[model samples]
Target chain A: MSVPTIKFYVREGLLPPGELTSPNQASYGETHVQRLRLIRALLDVGGLSVAGIRGVIEAIDDPRRPLHTVLGEAADQVVPRYERGDGSGIAEARKRVAELIEARGWRTYEGSPAAESLATALAALEEVGHGRFAEILDAYADAAERVARVDLEYVAHQVAREELVESVVVGTVIGDAVFAALRRLAHVDASDRVFGETP
Target chain B: MSVPTIKFYVREGLLPPGELTSPNQASYGETHVQRLRLIRALLDVGGLSVAGIRGVIEAIDDPRRPLHTVLGEAADQVVPRYERGDGSGIAEARKRVAELIEARGWRTYEGSPAAESLATALAALEEVGHGRFAEILDAYADAAERVARVDLEYVAHQVAREELVESVVVGTVIGDAVFAALRRLAHVDASDRVFGETP
Candidate 1:
């Protein structure tokens, strides 16, 4: 939290400007501190770019926006866009993603960014000759469902609409990191058990 | 994917140089192509750095490295290292991570990179006044265990030790991306269900 970084966020409109108490000085409130903390959390831990953070903060501050719309935008902004490719692997992967969604009875939107992200990963797996990895889609979806349920439960507990929206944005991004780390730990444990290796 | 990128990878030792077929001409084989794809997948899709890809390639090329050891190294390499902090939030988050691991009966190493990563996320959440988000740890870990079982089972079916190691590396990295995407989709569905919003 350097002065320059704080100034940068304020300049970028990711954080609100402090109130001017004098010609040469501004008085920062607790809200500014909290906002700065959230900004840092999103940037450092969530691995979001400045532009991505701006989008999230804009969604957070815009009361006219619907909560679901805000969440969708935040999630979409965080995921990298996949370029349209004519590769068969990508086409097949897209089909696989749709089938997985259908098989799992997930009610995601058509052309969901998550679906595209999954498709990109599947295509990459196929490109690397791990096409068979798609076989684990069901398992991955099952786990995803369970985690998502927990996330929604937490967000639903928020009484304030603004808090709920912010929770969804933060939870979606930081929760991904948390779950990924947990998955890695679980992988280590499972691999050790399967191979008879001591931890 | 480009000539320059391939040359860069070769220079970085992340990809091996092509064999010289003549005084001024070099030819690459299937191994080179596959290696190049793996490097690209790791860099472009897996979000690993050149140095991180180098570590993964080295692990893959080393026959003497045990599968679990190689997987650990690869997973460790992908996660950003957390700087030592004296903040109580970080210290508290670390304790929570340890508690979550113990409660879940996971056999992760004492200073496991996953644990550190989780602690870092937890700390960030707390920094943003979302310490209560740690409540979802048990649920996340449960889902993570289920996903890890499927991953290990898939790796176990690999006939060759090299394939097994590579699968773990790929599975740990790209699997995170895949699962994150799936989780986002699941989040959309769950949020819709909870808030009564149409997808």
Candidate 2:
């Protein structure tokens, strides 16, 4: 990173200021290097907005925030947000998501943004005339559970608290893009099986 | 759905011009109405750029593009794009993706952007020190296949080719958001299982 870039991250509170060695000189340590890497991952690989990156950094720096909930705050902004007008099937969609959570017996927090994000997506599917897509939600949940297990296992292996939170945050956000891209490739494979070649 | 939005879509070449009954008294039929819905869904739900929606419309309008290829075109831009510097592990990632495709016997096109997109993601994972995350590719591929099959089945049931194409395009983009949101919620559940309540 350059001088200006490091200064910028410092201004944004994304990184800690280096040790002031003189009126014009400063020194950074290993923590600075690791934070720089995390910031780069969030921006370049995760495609997080400035605000989203800030949210993740805040969660990390806040002592009051629980370790388990840190990634959730970072993730809320990292996931694309959405809304709908009245009569847009949003109410019913929310209800359905609520039922899925209840039926699954998952102990998540109240009003977690992930639930709303799922609801908004379901409503959007309905508005697009593909409400039937929701039928496959169970299958998707089953798959996602398997993935989250893999992810949590990776996260659990981290010895440091900061390392564990950062691990899950990166896994949750960038891992989304990874899974989505893989999904598209798999679509090509599945399409070939179902529809065959253009010829 | 409003007049100005409809005109905007027409101006952007996303919707066909209404038949000019008079200088300012053009009449639109069922096709226009359907096209309008698709435009809204792409904008509000899919979070696609104007350029992406235009790409989809062009694929729909062009005569030479095959049915199997249309969604692929729209999907390339819809899926997030990424890149990396030299010695960033990208070359190795690309080779791995190619091997995966060949191993799976998927007959997708040469240099398909989706393949490149997947490579970029895997490379990013490595750059972030989560290269082992790629180990779960088979699990993700399995889950994605199930979702894609369900998507194709719903698309196949549509009576008209136009409707079928629109169904798949809408499903592909919006479905990405839906699945990502679901994955996060599932993570919360998995976290509870692995770590219990944070005390």
Candidate 3:
């Protein structure tokens, strides 16, 4: 990380300032290094904005919040909020998302950010004449549930609360990238099988 | 989308020019509208860059290329190429990825984009002192395989090759967003179940 970037993170309250040990020099610790890496991962890999990272950092630093709550909030903050216009397509998509959640027996909160993100994606699909794509919602949900099970199991292994929180944040963000890449790889394999192409 | 944005896409050759009826009158057909919506979804939701989307469009528009070839090229183009700087961490991660692929019996190409992307993510995890996260690779790959199965099944329903190519492109890009969102929702539910939090 560059000096200006570190300064910017400190200025934006995404990272804590180094300890002032000298008149013109400050002493940084391992936490600073670790936080900087996390911030870079979130920005570069997670595609989060500075403000979004700030929200996540704030949630992490708050001691009173439960771990799961912080995780939910941080996950929610990463996705950009979409404005719901008078488009009936989005409304219809939102209803489909609700029905999928109900049918799957998923216990998500009302107005879950993920639900909104799914609705936005569904609406875009409809706009492009792929409204029928919603037919695969159950399949996607099944895979998502399996992925989540593994993720939670991994995070559960962390003994430290701080480490646990940080793990969720990092895992949720970078894990998305990891899963996406794997999905693409799997796509290639599946396509090869379907088209009789040699890998 | 805005006029200038559409103009930029047209200038970039990412979108075809609208039909000209007069000197200052141009009419965009359904193809243009659908392409614009796809572009927006890739940009806004999929978080792909202009250059990346351009490469994908190029692959899709090329008739000589086979379907699987186009899918691989498009997937490769989305991930920002990461240069290995004699870093043992990335090297180690790459090796792990190779092992995971072999153990899973997945027939991915050498230096696959997904492998490179996974290495980048793993290296980042190591940078943040979470290198152990690689231990969960099998679980992730399993879920990814299932998701890809469903994705391919959905795309297989498209009888037209043109629609098949478009489906893979759209499904790969928007599908990432859709899956990521669902994963987050699953995380919330999983966390709730694990932590005994009432949803």
Pick by lDDT: which candidate is best? 3
Please give, for residues A1-199, the per-residue lDDT of candidate 1 as tens digits.
6888899889999988889988879989999998988887787778888999999889999998878778787888778747535453887888888888887788886578889988988999898889889888888888888898889889888989888888988898889889889888888888777775573
For residues B39-71, write the lDDT of model 1, one tens digit per residue.
877876788888998898899899988778888
Provide the TM-score of chain A alone for each candidate, in the order shown.
0.93, 0.91, 0.93
Off by over 4 Å in 3: A81-88, B81-88
Q: If ranked by lDDT, best first, what sequence of candidates would result?
A: 3, 1, 2
lDDT of 2 by residue, A33-124 (tens): 87887788788767788778888988977767777787687678776676566577778888899999998877776457888878888887
Residues B1-199 of candidate 2 have per-residue lDDT tens digits of 5789788878888889999999989998988777776777777767788888999888877767667777787688686576456567878998988887887666665467888777877887776677887777777777777777777777788877677677778878888888888788888878766765753
Which pairs of residues have clashing backbones in candidate 2?
none
In model 1 chain B, the worst 10-residue window by lDDT is: B81-90
Q: Model 1 misses residue B8 by how many Å?
A: 0.6
Q: Per-prediction RMSD in angstroms?
A: 1.7, 2.5, 2.0
DockQ, per model, reads: 0.75, 0.63, 0.69
Docking class of 3: medium
